[model samples]
Target: MLEKLIDDFKLQPPHAVLLALEPLRAISDYVAGIVGPAEALPRGDGHPVIVFPGLALSGAATADLRVRLQQLGYELYDWEQGVNNWPDADFDEWLQRLGAHLQRIHARHGRSVSLIGWSLGGIYARELAKKYPKLVRQVITLATPFTDTGDSTHAGWILTLLNGAAYAVDEALLKRLSVDPPVPSASIYSQTDGVVAWQGCQGKETRCHRNIEVNRVSHMGMVHHPDVLRVVADLLVEPC
Candidate 1:
């Protein structure tokens, strides 16, 4: 299953992928700009844009992102509790903690916030959006393996915990998070994403929700890729 995804990425022109996903990204960002708070939030913005780092990402990875967003003229909130590695964490407890933070950001910023979660953070962002839609203005998932009912692509550690949890991809959850004709979300992928299979990052529907593929960017670098940054800036700087 992953083989085709990878091959297609290698075969597909990244420029074409970016062209495909740009519309949806623009739409989501535009809506967020309209509904989201419009002040140049202080450092961390009080409403604080939340960012979730990718697998094995260090502070430096998101460091550039934070700085870039700031340079682009937007405030971002710190996860404070960084690098949410896929530990054997209690799902409910984790959500609670994250939810509490969202509440805190909302109380402080008094505006809808955007979630930029990389890979696993993308999944986390989706769950959080469902849990607190009122607080979330938009969602961006980077190279996240949103759908992969195959064990072939997972790392060894993952297989140990979800040896056969392929079916656990949860269509219900995907449906709930679908930002189609109405919802606002973006799933960014790269033809060279060394991590999760590119196919796994796509959205089957193109209307409201979309899967965007950028080129040359590695799964890790996608978090900071210039093209990715421009897309993000475009989304963040809109009217909302």
Candidate 2:
């Protein structure tokens, strides 16, 4: 299984120099968001949308994105799970809690929810949608390497540290993760992403699935890059 994971998803992480420039590129993306001409976007139909943060990040990390979607008239919801530190001893419990949260939101709105996840958060979004397809309207993942085991990410060591020997590949989980969710879904990635290998960030494209690439966006910048936001906006308002 490990050999297969290596063979199938063994793309190299971004160059060290690119990793070093990530913060600068993120700043540039922020500036561009401020000065770029407004794009004409379709208004959201007030469906509930949830934004999930990346590993070790709290929902606060997605504030700008949430605000943008909210302005488009969508009801934005936080992950509300605090920092996303997955693969902990309580990982199953945490997922159960998340499932219950989703259930409550679905009950409250009486509508399927849209999920947007960044980095590792995107992995969670896909799995959640898979587990409860009837409750999800669509999914959009930003720079998430769901097709790869930790081998293709700069953050691989972080997962190793967190999971110890337990971090070894789970073929079943990997197989599941690599499959696109059963709802309308899009993967937004960048060739210049400086954390995870971009090749692992996409899946097979079908009528309801897409791999949209942006140029020169850092892995960390995907949450706020204007190009990424535009793609996300267009996908959100797409007819279901």
**lDDT accuracy of residue 23 in candidate 2:** 89
Compared to the true structure, candidate 1 yields what TM-score? 0.69
Which regions in candidate 1 have their CA more than 4 angstroms from the true location? 1-47, 150-183
Tens-digit per-residue lDDT, 30-86, candidate 1: 444334334443233333578877655545557767776765555686665655555
lDDT of 2: 0.86
RMSD of each: 9.5, 3.0
Candidate 2 clashes between residue pairs 3 or more apart in a chain or in different chains = none
Structure candidate 1, residue pairs in collision: 33-239, 33-240, 34-240, 47-109, 179-208, 179-209, 180-208, 181-208
- Alpha-carbon runs more than 4 Å astray in model 2: 1-9, 89-93, 161-167
TM-score computed on alpha carbons, candidate 2: 0.91
lDDT of 2 by residue, 112-162 (tens): 999999999998898889888999999999999988765668876666676
- TM-score to native of every candidate shown: 0.69, 0.91
